[model samples]
Target: MNKGFYFERNLLALSRFDPALCSRLSGAETTRGRYRFIESRSGESIPALVDNSGAAHPLHSLVDPRREGKRLISTLGNEGFLIIFGLGGGFHIEAALEKTTIEGITVIDFDIHGVAELLSSREYIGIFNDPRFRLLVDPSAEALEQYILDRYKPVICGGISLLPLRTRADFSQGLFNQAGEAIKSAIDMVSADYSVQAYFGKRWFSNIIRNIAQAEQNTVPLAPVHSVAICAAGPSLDAQIPLLAERKNRPFIIAADTALPALISAGLTPDAVVSIDCQHISYYHFMAGLPEQTLLFLDLASPPLVASRSPRPYFFSGGHPLTRYISRYWRPIPEVDTSGANVTYAALSLAEYLCARNIELYGADFSYPRGTSYARGTYIRSLFENKQNRCIPLEALHSAFLYRTPLFKQGDENNSWYYETKPMAMYRLRLEEKVRSMKARIVVVPGMGAPIRLETNTGDNRTADTLRLFSSGKAAMGALEFLAQYRAGINALPLLQGPVYSFLTGLSKEETIIFTTLLPAAAALKRSAPELDTPELFDAVKKYCVGELEKLLGIWGMR
Candidate 1:
């Protein structure tokens, strides 16, 4: 074997793609005492990590690292994505490549110098050549997070498993710990999004059909707004409402669904009200009756009946892949980020989408400030009051709502208590991310909850004048025709038992678009029946989605 030739080829490949890493490897020759290569019983060489003290920590079994790596990877079955926390001479990663047909494998290691030394010794051209293989040397938390978000596909990948070389991790404890935290954070974020999709995937599709028809009739006005106030239903709204009412006409007001009742009771009229919740209970927010001038903005995934509450309602597509598919293929609909999982976030997205330069946040506490769940006159208060009876008292309902989730204390203060569940925390974190990147001047009102820290860009005066309206012209195919074609497309999907990619690749352009509409529902089914194999799971999802679509078609026929 031409060992020197192989090393030169690998070095050239590294230099081409990772020049910075190649530069670090300039003279990374390993000393005899520091790292010794030992041959195993199976005739495979394994490198040992030696510290300043005489202790040597071997990453894999001394008998055979390759054999041990293959055994470990065999237990993982067929996970589409593999994440290795420590490189450990790349034995595990190489074994994973040899044993599994995974979508990708990510390797993270703290020591760039050590990696360079290892690269200089071994031929890793195979790992480097594979398009799916990724190596992150000494990656920061943000870099690790961004890489995971860009690559990890919860729907396509199914699940991801994290493998760590304990001996290697013990050598660099702090770095591995940080990398672990980054992985958990990224996974949690993706899981939360997928969970939402599972619950509302079918609902989103059904609502999009109705909302698209509604949008066709009454389009959202493409007007320019200089400034806007986004009102959330936090307890702090009680104090902010007076000030908001005093200067009501100064800025355009976009009230969240929960805040609409509070604004109305405070003798204030918002310019518009936005609703994104898929539940029927969202209807309670509009019981007081919507004003004539107050336009209603709803997500395409919202309860279809809510759109009928206002004659001037405009529908915008939220963070649903199905909604996006409809917008792309059938008709164009205004899209906004609803990922924050709260109406307040949707309201903020609306203001930003409309190009509101100066945004004043009112009652966006995100937490239940001082044990209060909602504003003074929010719909929850009236709903509980109306449902009050001998069985369930009004105070009981209010208390139950406030203390439904475990509360956590935020900030250092005697009375700074707030209800913070995992979902609520995710919502706050998402909003913080959104607010940080916004070009608008965001002003947050201080309240008895977690403080929002966002960097503002006051100097920039970007306007939405360039925002074009959706084409009002009739689509090439009407809703009925589109449904008919979609039904045929679903019916044409390849049968189960083969690889999912093979089935997916067989689909035409129109069939692919139709396939995405069922992913959310499929993901939901996959969650409940996880024991089913990929093909079987997909077949079940196809059947369930087809049934739902048929029901929608029946309803559309009656309309």
Candidate 2:
């Protein structure tokens, strides 16, 4: 453990934060066959790995590992989060930490034993001392996926990229490949969500302000129920409607927005309906008269007009980051997992939030059965029919709706053919994961789409007599006051005339939050204009977001 003064200083820094890790590293044992130090041309020693063939392979350059590391990092251009697949000597990780633009880095490597051996022989305290660095050893696909989902935030991180050490990846090819695919899966999932955020981030902030008046009421927690039925607008609902109508009163019925028309047509009444989409297209779902006694559960980011449609509408926070900030800072509300990206997913979450013990999913086909896009009496059919002309008949419109997107066919014609798409598949997978996590008897009725399997009988049913209230007291500041403070904060942000890093570092807490509201949009702008420098990007993002907010304030006449 004899290292240079600078290296010893790095270990001392790590010891201050993680004494346990330092003690473990001190006790670690490494053999020559496992790891050996190789001196560079600059007289700096680096660690190398020994292979099964008794050949030594340096983890870094014999000339200068630091130089090689910087070269590798330069290729990434600008990114907020970096995922390194190997922790060989920690040279690359140390280089990444030097970049101020990189907010965080996650290092994952296979074989914790081998990593321990390498740590024993090398001084990696420089890499370990960084507050932004995280280490994961011998992680499973599930563990890696969860870590990425939990740590990476597209709005805050801006962009994420993964880099793998070819030398080390080649040794544990199987594990590294699995890790790569898992990371890719998580990225794809996050990208889909980020796309949504990019489109509606500003709208979400505005919607929260508009919905604040509605959400100020005390949130009502649900009374425990023995059974609940979640109704979706999938094509299978055509047949399931009769059974649902028969047992409508047996279990509490929660219908998705799209399923409201189908359920109403079937002469059934649902106890509650959930809607999460912020787009105006969602208004069509409520074209039919809402049931008087039925409650409407709308995401705080939902279109403002949607809340006015129902007398007993309850506003809840969804996946929007702005809504999250409002929930934490202004007032808290019950949150529903809208990550499923569909109304049915939100409906199921509402049911879970209600503590339903026996939850049965109806019409959650999540596919096109026999090329039927929706149930028999959904709003689409009538809307298409009304819009049809001599050139385009009602049947033709229906056909076009079903054929709009190419679908993956599952099952044979003898049984039933179901069509699936990437979005549908992702939604089903997310729902399956949610069902497995919930400790309830969740059942998905046989449908025309891919089958959903959930782990049942975990025996963790919630039996609370009352639901937790989201808004316990009046907000510390009203919407107008909050908007005024936010406006001042946005206006006070440092101009992009200075260095990008300096401007970011100089931001006050309020300015930082305001800046967060701009990142998703900034990322979007950067994607479209890659030629823009960091300062130019920051300028554009700040100007665009602040201008938009200014317009909103002017329109509201609140300033």
Candidate whose lDDT is highest: 1
lDDT of 2 at 505: 55
- Candidate 1 lands at a TM-score of 0.80
Question: Which digits, one per residue and each the tens of the lDDT, describe model 2 over residues 1-559?
Answer: 4433434454466575457655654454344346667888977677666788878777778888878988889899677889988888777888888887887788888765566666655667767766677777778899899889877876445678888876877877899899999999999888886787657655665566677666765555556566889999988888887887776358989999998988998888888888888877888888888988888899988888888897547888886656666666676667888887888888877777776778889999888887778887788977886899999988899887777877788878777877888789888888887787776678777777677877543646654223533233457787666766666766777776432333555666656666666666676676677677666877887776667667666777876
lDDT scores of the candidates, listed in order: 0.75, 0.75
TM-score of the candidate numbered 2?
0.85
lDDT of 1 by residue, 1-559 (tens): 3535545666677665467766665545433454555666776666677788876677778787777888888888667788987776677888887753576788898666566546655778877766567778888998898888766866666779988877888888988899899999898878777887777666666676656556657454566577899999988999998888788367999999899999999999988999998878899899888989898888878887898897657777785767777677666777888878888888888888877778898998888776678888898877788899999998788888877677776654666767666667778788988887777778887776667777543425463343544223346567776666666677887674343443555677767667767777777777777787666766887887667667777878822
Task: Indicate which candidate wins on TM-score.
Answer: 2
Q: Each model's TM-score?
A: 0.80, 0.85
Model 2 error, position 534 (Å): 4.3
Q: Which 10 residues in a row give candidate 2 its minimum summed lDDT?
A: 464-473
